[model samples]
Target chain A: MLELSRRRFLIGVGLSGLAVASPRLMAAGSSAGEQTFHSRPIPSTGESVPAIGMGTWITFNVGGDQYLIDERTRVLETFLERNGTVIDCSPMYGSAADVIGAGLDKLGAHDRIFAATKIWTSDGSETREQAATSERRWGIDRFDLLQVHNLLAWQEHLVTLKEMKAEGRVRYLGITTSHGRRHRELARIMETEPLDFVQLTYNVLDREAEERLLPLARERGIAVIVNRPFQGGSLFRRFQSEPLPSWAPEAGVGNWAEFFLKFIISHPAVTCAIPATTRVEHMQENMGAMYGQLPDTSQRRMMADYVRQL
Target chain B: MSGATWLSYSLQDFVMFGPEVFLRLFARINQDLWPWLLLWPLAGLVLPWFGRQAAELPRRLAMALAGLAWIGCGYLFLVRYYGPVNWPATRFGWAFVVQGLFLLILKGRALPGPMAWPVAVSWWLAVLLLPWLSVLEMPDLWAIALFGLAPGVTVAATVLLFAGQPSPLRWLLLMLPLVWSLFSAATYWALGTFWLMGFPVATLVLLVVALRFNPSPAQNPGSQSVHRGPGRQSP
Candidate 1:
């Protein structure tokens, strides 16, 4: 199987999105032996997304700069090379959706891509128009997920999203909040409303989500997409001077990137962790966390405590 | 940096460009235009007129100009210009366009009645503060604090100069710049440039003041000012 995957990776599907088989990804393992890519179900439809995904906050917001766009294309290629899906973007992130679309078009990787973006307006009319604009920007017919950014006018947009879902314009509907801004309001909405997913900030340092939001998601069967898994790059700045914990390889955690990511996805309710990156090597490192052995519950606590000590 | 050095580097290294880059970009956009010197001053003149008099024309004209400001920031600054250099400007361009339209149809007094001293102070501060930006010791190209174009200045002026009650339409118009001010504050901090933190702070302060001085419905229902947008005749 590994041999076949090597052939497929070398010459696969013309870089077609999902079908670009990457079984060879399992061959190159962390401290652990060979392992396959891990995926979690999107609780609503039971369809699985890769445990790792890409985010386009500041990283992909390079507007109209062709040089940067080409550089980002290299990053996307590396991501696909490592078998990534679920590229998350928002109109609020400047020209990210456009840049991502441009990169995917360059690579002919659209077929395998599972794209997601947000409807970020306060009114229903704007929401409808922005969603359409997002569709055009991403160069995709229907989004896998359409989130209400920061719950701005969520009440009005929710009605429109539901209708869009019914009309086959969007595959799933969810809402996002970040910076730990509105968890209580988010919780009430999760309990009262039916949604496929909820995107929020959750990391080793910011474990507040574990208190209610994560468990609520588990109970409500809502897949959680974790953002700011690096706390907007705060994690690296904090730990870059320190060496990786000597025993990190015990859980297949090779480096800080994998360590931070493994801790995020190890949570039972997490569907994926979308960490943005502009460099190909960083993309490779981020994707490496996907094949590793995730820490068990007690081990997760240990990882958290270890980081807290630092 | 060597290849290994680069690979090991973190996100701080990847953010690309410095604070001066952004400020210079804005300055380049404002290049050699003396006519624009009067833009904000004139808007300042029109902004407070929403409240002092009963004539709807001044308020309408201000709202129309406010629309132009939104579209100016959206199209002239954000899309046609800034977007080519920055990604946020593209989406923000859409925001400006939407806000400009919202203002075009907006109905209300700029203030419910006589301008509050706080509002007046805030407006004067927005204009007077321009020269003081020299104290910021920023690069000449980076000295952009014009209304309608910059984020925080836009927010302060929007709230301070708003005519009347917070209708759904008015709030819709206010939402983007309010959000943009916060984003701008954080971005400036990251870029290590002007603290620019005051935009969001001033916006909140003005909002609190406006809510307090707001007129009761009995005082100004704004029924006459609120009319359907163009081509839709009143019954």
Candidate 2:
């Protein structure tokens, strides 16, 4: 009996070592070489998307520099190569939408992309106009998701978004806020509004959402798309130097990027985590989180505890 | 948002683009305006020679060159390049053109006295040394941001060119530099590209020194001598 138990322990250790060696094999969740990313359902429609998405806040706003634009296209290609779907942008993000359009035009992958953008004007009556402009920039007939950015004129924008949804111009409608601003107001919207998704800031460090907004999202049957999953790159700046905890492999975190991203997407309320990156390697690292084993409740507590101590 | 709510935000929240894209603007603009880029620094190099002349036409020509620099930068760099990434740059670009027009239309004259040696050194530093600063940071010849082409260097040198001019015109012309300095500083700080922050800081410093050393008519008794050249009209 002693020899049998020892043999089982050695096998477990060998498998864990192999998992650390090839994250793709580990992400497959089995011995199969084919990888599978975790997908979460839109409670309203039952449609689902991979838990990892790309954000275009600063990373994609390359403007008229054709060189930079081409570089961004490659980043998009890397994303699509990995089967990434949801890509979120905003008009307030300057030329990001246009750059994305240019990239999509080059790749001709508009059909495969789940284009998500925001209506950011303060004028409540300009919802349709803003959406149209965004559509023109994205070179798409419709946006998969149209969000009232930062709850700006949310009431009026929501009404128009609903109209557009009925008109088949937008697939989903939602509201967004970031840096943990206006949570009380966002919570009110989540409680009262007919939202398909709610995007907000939630990461390992920024846990204020865990108290109310996240729980409310789950209760309202609203999908949650997390923004600033890396807290605008501050998470890596802070935690990159620290050693990954012994249990990191158990949670399937290969590097700091996956470590931070997996924590957010692993949350039951989060449908996806949009972590923006300018580098193709970082995108690959971020998408790696979509695969692999997610931490359970006890392991999550342990993850948070380790970071707080650091 | 309330003040309490505003506290939740930080500088990174307001900044959309990273330093890589911002610094690459120099290389991109340099490629777009090659050969013509040389004229800007040439215009900058001759301004002091014009400033030394007692003739009003030379001084006026100097101001016109400065005006052209502003318009060129405003159009090429801000409007065509930076505006796409940062939307508000377009409005600032138009304002720069207006400032350029002001420089072109305004009469120019030599200062009543020789420019302070320190102020001369600062102007030379801005024109000669400032463009290479970006090269030091980016380590590329194309990344060199020249005066009259790059806003930070152009604004810095302009404050010195108009140093001998009488205000409220001097103060009026200096306003944009001051604003640009603060705005650029904030942007660089938020992007965590502390190296580029020096450009705006240098502009602000030169602005302060120029304003201090070159006093206006109300402040200096000898200010009247600036209007002593041929065809000059006294206020």
Candidate 3:
């Protein structure tokens, strides 16, 4: 009986080890293979962004304690190693910009970052001050993209951004809104304002952007950044039990999150889709969506129908 | 100072002539749901904190309040901004139902053990169905039932399965706020704005504090190690 129990224990340990190691092994195998970049042209400049961008909204705000600080540093290192260029954060995100600054400093990756951030305050003076503070925090001389976040103080900030752009303090000036709330205003802004980019929500679950914002962006030659491809956590929750649809393979989506994200980026207007992830594994999966064929118009419709059916 | 004055004046004027401002804003816009969307994370951050003091009761009240707030906000926005469009009443109702189930499952006496599949299943079904129906336009009830509800329920179920006797899933489920922090970040990032970024950072700090200040394992019945099946025990 003792011997039998000992054998059982050994077998259990072996099985558990295998279960844990299998994923790591698969990951290693995948990484060992060749790496590639999937490029999309910026509508305004016709320059290409590497499709995948790192969002630092929650993940970058790692401060207060030592352990969290350490974890955040690791996350930053992982992000840089993954070839992610676009680092999106804002002053409204509670030290996110500051933390990311520190992370970039630690990783020595500041120059590598495609720094994208927003001015959230409504007052023009505050907007200018915040924009300056963001620059100081990130330790950058010029911002790649300075966006008016959620249309909050958009007009006030737009004038400031235009001035900054003219003075060479910012490379691009744009406005962003998520949640399909201000597409019409966004459209007007797109029409009148000489915006280089427009960021908004676009996911399989929330495709309201498709009806107008996307076409407007395309027509106006504004680069599009898709936010909320997962609908916060709603998409993840929805796909938890459901197997990846068979059609996912055709679109090069290895997981459900990618399936949703790839669908958004597949749009011609989308220069990049920023999907924030805390876990390294999730970031890797999201990056995979950047690779492979994005659905063409017909494929996008088909994909949309498939997701709707699910 | 003059800039601040002008800003306040502009906002006050905008508020005073709300109808005109709405018309002007919506003239070219297809729909304006931005203000309504801001309430989601605002409710998420505020409700949990307000309910923190009352423990389970406060949580339940907050959930109900949030549900009501969402419905009311949606209605007000539709009426004020969208102008009596064909809004989906059933979807809004389902959102409240899901929120109710979520609160029930979360606030119940001593977190239900893994055996509480009913609560998990129901909560999952509601969230999946609410969003799928309202947001995604998915029509299949079974797909909503299976996919939407399954992941979170499974996470809870896994926690419950590992939880030892006398310790319900609640203690382990406290890790949920950490997970929620992740989701909140993802949501904000996906939404492409920096709002709600503070909540996750605050939650993370709170979690760290709770971990530090909370009583040691000897004092808590739920601290016992969970046993796996057939001679297996967690390390």
Candidate 4:
């Protein structure tokens, strides 16, 4: 049976190659032994998303050059190897969604991906069109999660999204906002909308979300996706010439990036924190944030105090 | 006279180039003329309004020439200050390059928009203070008191200068240069340059000049206009 499964895998690889002619498939199959997978439960659905999701906002904005495509394919492979299924993209992040789609195709991870994207336009028609475009771009009949980006045109999109959810075209309907600018609005929507998930910026430095949005999400039974876990590179800057705080080890954070991210994910409300990275090493570091001992409430306060001191 | 004398002579030859040698070194260092390149428009727009007409021509000409010469000088200084393949410098250089490219593509200009001034200033401060603040246990006491104070001073000066009709945005904008200068000072320290001591003097001069030559014109009826004190329009 083991031999049979191995042969099936080989056949899957052969078919995948014949179907897509992707070198990524060849590499992925060849390096299966080297890959590691990690998983976390989706708060709403109980389905696991590989803890290390790919962020295509800034890194995947490299358009469609072959180099970028190859790098993206590797990134996808890395994520998949680590049991990561979430690929967060947005229509608002330049050409990232399109690039991610192409990378997904090249990596043959389209079906494997827990595909996530946003509808940013205001008009209902335009929102619908954008959703359709995302579907076409990703070459998928159904999306794992379709979010309203920054609450823009969300009211109009939510109705259609609900309809789509009922139609089984979208597995989840959600909303997201970055920058912590609209937490009050997000909380209101979480209360009003039947949201499965909600994404927003939350990190140690910016604890404003914790004041209300986090608890609200927990109460609403919405899975919380943390964005800008590194505070858009500000946290890293704070650690530039400084040694990692000694207490970081107590919380099981090895590096400053992981330290910041782990603090965010440690919150009970946080399902996942999608920290973007351009380097595979950084991807690995970010993924590590998902594992290990998380800071408790006391430790989180300690971390906050430490950051303030810096 | 002695073996030590011969070694010292060789070392001096390598390190301290004679006056003629220093001139050539400066020429090589100044090849790209980046400092001068950046200084030209600053002088052209700023100096004349300062009532320093005699200084203007010489300063402008010197800046233009320096801009031309510093390309090489700047390269040499960079090579000396940061060893070959310095990651941080390389990163900053690439950032500038990409920014220049982006500006070119978007606005058909190499320089950023005026709104970018605040951002630039903020970046400069961050660059200077971040490194120090990172390692220091008491950043407020040491780093903030020393370097961080500049932004406060600049902000206060802007508020005072703008007085009753001040736009908060303009006051915020002044903080940029202060922050940036702090960052540069920090960078110099990180690079182990004794010459960084001269930075405060340069910063003071720039601050005074910047305050002296206000961007707002007198005839402009904008509320944010910088009018000369008592009744006359501010230069």
Candidate 5:
């Protein structure tokens, strides 16, 4: 009986070990067979988070289609399997929150997920309603991060977010903007407001955020979640035809996803970059960015110049 | 800014409003009313053919169903379902109601005739079954178009009904459905729902038929002519 029990324990340990090893193996297989994920500290908490996170904009908006839901389930599975935590979504993104909820439910990913979504409506009452709706849709009691989407009624929503944070309904409060619309106002809010994180577009071509938002967030010790690292998949079209600089592999950039993502996360100010994707293969390539030596300042310059020339 | 560089967008992007916005509309409508709704489009196709005793009876019946199609879609789909996502749906719902009411009021004479049996049968088949077309060989009935929610059967029914009518007002009856067809097609295109391509294709066919079978209101006042519509080929 003792020998039998010992055998059962060994089997259990072996299976658990395989489960953990599989993800690292998958990461290594993709990243030229090495597994070491680099992380950056969230300045507010001084706690490190994996530099690469997931985004759910156009990618996870499959609505009620079971096939689409199943497809996205794999995406979230791949993300969490690779140690991805932050998942950014919005109420404006149609049925993405519901699908993400379903995916997390199916994978039993509730414990591991670092839930992040936005309130993207007008007025403070609507903000409260939308935030509750988002929580229900995501099947979570609370969120890790909640942002005022595009600063729409930002002041109104900020008050609610701060209260929620204070009440422990949410861990962090921040704001987001896109399409490069209202930077001056966002800058002022970040300076005057006590935000824990800020998400904004930053990539190879659209460096507009780098000018003001990134600098301000860093100065204020507000963790920056860089969005649109590939500029809404625009980088693929813009640079697909061009060959990667020969020296990219030296910095552990295996594909263009890494090339773009590495650039954003490598920035001293960028706490994390949430690159959105649907395909597991694409997610694997994205997680590859978290591994290896990120491009240094000169290499970042070389990468940008190559892109411009192309 | 599609106005500035419309050509710059790919055919896919030009059509897409995003899969979530596009598909969620179908899901909500489907969820609110599912198998019961399928019969609406089927009725739009099946009901009009029964009143063939009078030359104008079939035409009146067709017009009534067409109106119901518009009104049903306007209330259930445009106003109730789509109003939240698209602000313009409220106004479009009113327009559909007006169009439907016009059909109810203006059942005066035979427009021309119902589409030939073959064309009519094809409309029925496409409406009932097209959404079932799938690469995975499984159907999501939620995506299917019922009569009032969208135009799948109803548009075809109206086109067939007006194939026999030759009044100037047929253009008024035809106008909104055509625009809606184009809009639905663009949404389908964006969602990568290839089977719904028939919506836009049917719109194109109707355009050619409208130009050929009917006259510009300027070309002939009263514009009553002997020419038949696209469905004239059936007989």
Candidate 6:
């Protein structure tokens, strides 16, 4: 099993998110042993990160509840153990950033994770202040990625984010919009601005991004982080009751989680897919997508058609 | 953003936490305020009795106690507890403290018109029945959202207790509760906790009815029987 420490892993990977089939990863299957997950590189920097990352939106916003905090800590542990990195959060998510900080503190796994949060204040002047506060909240020296949340004051924040990136304060800087919002503005930003990553909503069902943004990211050599990969858990509500298609195994999808996640990460342009979950089992299932065979273009089409029919 | 763009989002999009996390707030707050939790129910029970008293001094003292409850609920529950999960809750908590001060310092006679027996029964319902709803949902005794402690129940019961106050001051006092009803309603609805959603919706209904069903001064018992001196007319 490949159980490399965070520093060793980063050094070994050398920021290449390109996939490599590991005999160790395949051999460690269905066991407590650490397994290798597929990683994709940041297009600009060639920094590799696990294609399947955890999202701390509602899942990690457990507030001051000690029990819930402890529970989320275990989930974070599960994600880290499975070789998952690139944990994404936002200041807009109430206590999510705080809870991530708490979970990191409890697990002492800060070094093992890629901490990405956003600057959400509408005041452009407060961009650095907000980032400073988020740094304290996450208990991190600096953020790996900082994005303008929902395009609020994007113009002003983008200037600050660029400066921070130049000063080595933030590893990557970008802008984000979710629930299929502000695509025109986001696309325009991608075209005009120099960004390291762009976060947007895309799932098997919500494929509006496929028409433009995904291709645009590929064309621009900008990495894409897909949010709402499960369509806020609605896809499961719609499809969980149904049986998997007979060809599901051909795509290496054992459950609905892999079925949903593999579709997103399989996209050549996608750097990662962030699906938030509160359960350890669910986190395990989500991390499972980072391994196994991703769907080819034909398989991808078949998977989409199968979901569409169902 | 266009209306079509804005309308595309759902209520759940705004609510960032689940019922599992939200309901535990009651248990957490209850545990934090153990033993002192006894005072909330005591304040709830005694408040209506003071409303019925002919003497303004007893009513003033009762309102002061109720004011203390608001301060406690707002600061301890809303600010320290719920605010961590919901940012708007901190602002609402400060508003609750202000409402508490209003109850403490505002003229007691401004809250003329003793609560009718029917309204008083509803007040009892808020005090006795509503808190248990949390207990039922979480199936934990520690999850009880006691009156004068939980914002939802406290706001509901307060709406009923102050139903008889005159306008302007009455509106001023009830404004936070009314706004709270909307916030709670949206929150609960988004969380898909319909059972918890009913409390805020009921508070909103009670507010509408209380403001609309104002009886004439001649028909009011508190106006005719309670002291209606020239100096005490304005809130």
* lDDT (C-alpha, whole model) for all candidates: 0.71, 0.82, 0.55, 0.54, 0.70, 0.81
DockQ of each: 0.12, 0.75, 0.02, 0.02, 0.13, 0.81
Lowest lDDT 10-mer window, candidate 4 chain A? A28-37
lDDT of 6 by residue, A210-229 (tens): 98899999999898999999
Cα lDDT tens digits, model 4, A187-288, are 889988899999998888888988898999888888888887887666887765777788877776778877787687668777777877666777777776
Runs of candidate 2 exceeding 4 Å displacement: A1-36, B109-118, B212-227, B230-235
Report, to 2 decimal places, the DockQ of model 2: 0.75
Residue range A1-310, candidate 3, lDDT tens digits:
1122332344334434543754332221122222324546666565445576877654554333234455666766766565566778777565467667777787776666678899888677786688788989888765788999888878889988889887777777888886666678889889999999999988887888888888888888899888777776578887767777677666566788677877877677788888876667788788777555555667778777876787
Give me the displacement of residue B3 in model 6, in angstroms. 3.8
Model 5 misses residue A282 by how many Å?
Answer: 1.0
Question: lDDT (0-100) at residue B192 of candidate 5?
Answer: 69
For candidate 2, chain B by itself scores a TM value of: 0.88
Task: Give the alpha carbon lDDT tens digit for every residue of B203-229 in model 4.
Answer: 554455444443433422343321212
What residue pairs are clashing in model 5?
B73-B148, B111-B164, B111-B165, B111-B166, B112-B164, B112-B165, B113-B164
Of candidate 1 chain B, the 10-residue stretch with the lowest lDDT total is B226-235
TM-score of 5: 0.73
lDDT tens readout by residue for model 1, A207-284: 889999999999999999999999878799999789877778776788899999999988888999999988899999
Badly placed stretches (over 4 Å) of model 6 are: A1-36, B204-215, B218-235
Task: List clashing residue pairs in candidate 2.
Answer: A27-A292
Better of 4 and 5 by TM-score: 5
TM-score of chain B of each: 0.75, 0.88, 0.30, 0.32, 0.69, 0.87
The worst-scoring run of ten residues by lDDT in candidate 6 chain B lies at: B226-235
DockQ pick, better of 4 and 6: 6
Instruction: State the lDDT of candidate 3 residue by residue for B1-235, as single tens digits.
Output: 2364445332221211112222222221213343343444344334434333323444345445434443442333323322221123224334424443554444323221122223223333333332232122223322221111222222222222123213344354344434544753554344433423544553444334433433333444432322211121111
Runs in model 4 deviating more than 4 A are: A1-39, B1-235
